[model samples]
Structure formats: structure tokens, C-alpha cells
Target: MKVICILCDEAFTPSKFQARKIMKHPHKIQICETCHDRITTKVNMQRTAKP
Candidate 1:
């Protein structure tokens, strides 16, 4: 099924199981892999940075 990334607004097709899970859970937000990876990297950097 086709899903739009909430962060980047890019359209992508996820696997059938993922699509169904997203559909079933209204609170879940869909994000493309690229955006997910970007956010993950940023978060990891923040975690490792000394304050």
C-alpha cells in the first residue's frame, strides 16, 4: 500500500504487513526510510555529544 512520509511528505510503498499495521493503528505516523535514517543519525549524535 502507498503511504506518505509525515516528515518529508514523500510517497512510498511499504510491505503489506506494515501497511496493515499502520492502517489499523491511527496514531502511528509513516516516515520514509531516508528520513528515518537521518533522524536516527541525528539522535545518535546528540546522545554521544558531551554537554
Candidate 2:
């Protein structure tokens, strides 16, 4: 099924396997790989940064 990234608004299609998993959470917004990676990096940086 087709999905759009909530963060970057990018459109993409998920595999049948992924689609099933995603459908399990109908209320949750989907995020693309690019945005997911970017967010993950930012979070990791924050966690590792010196206070």
C-alpha cells in the first residue's frame, strides 16, 4: 500500500510485509527512511552530547 511520510511528506510504497505491520497501528503516522534516520541521528547526538 502507498504511504506518506508525516515528517517530510514524501510518498512511498511499503512491501506487503511492512504494510501488514503498519496497518496494525492505523492511528500512528508513517515516517519515511530519510526522516526516520535524521530524527534518530539527532536524538543520538543529543544523548551523547556533553551537558
Candidate 3:
């Protein structure tokens, strides 16, 4: 199934398991892997920088 990322607005195909989870939970926001990794890296950097 094709899913669109909320952040980048890019469309991507996720695994069947993920698609099912998203379908089951309509309230969950979907984000592409790229955006997810970027956000994770930024948060990690900020956390480590804070002492």
C-alpha cells in the first residue's frame, strides 16, 4: 500500500505489517523513513549536546 509522509509529503510503500498498523490506527501520523531518521538524528544530537 502507498502511504504519504505527513512531514515531507512524499509517498512511499511500507511493509505490510506497518500498513496494517496504520490502517488499524487511523489517528497515527505517517512519516517516511527519511524524515523519521532525520528527526531522530536531530533529537539525538540535541540530547547529547545538553550535557
The prediction achieving the highest TM-score against the true structure is 3
Worst window of 10 by summed lDDT in candidate 1 = 14-23
Query: Per-model C-alpha lDDT, please?
Result: 0.88, 0.84, 0.92
Report the CA-based lDDT of candidate 3 relative to the real structure. Answer: 0.92
Candidate 2 segments whose C-alpha is farther than 4 A from its true place: none
For residues 11-46, write the lDDT of model 3, one tens digit per residue: 999888888998899799999999999999999999
- Give TM-scores for every candidate, taking all chains together and pairing residue i with residue i: 0.80, 0.78, 0.89
- Candidate 2 or 1, higher lDDT: 1
- Which residue pairs in candidate 2 have backbone atoms (N, alpha carbon, C) closer than 3 angstroms, thus clashing? none
Residue 16 of model 1: what lDDT?
80
TM-score of 1: 0.80
Candidate 2 lDDT, 1-51, residue by residue in tens? 789988778898877876997989878787877888899999999999968
lDDT of 1 at 49: 100
Give the residue spans of candidate 3 off by over 4 A.
none
Candidate 1: where is the Cα deviation over 4 Å? none
Lowest summed lDDT across 10 adjacent residues in model 3 is found at 14-23
How much is the lDDT of residue 13 in candidate 2? 88
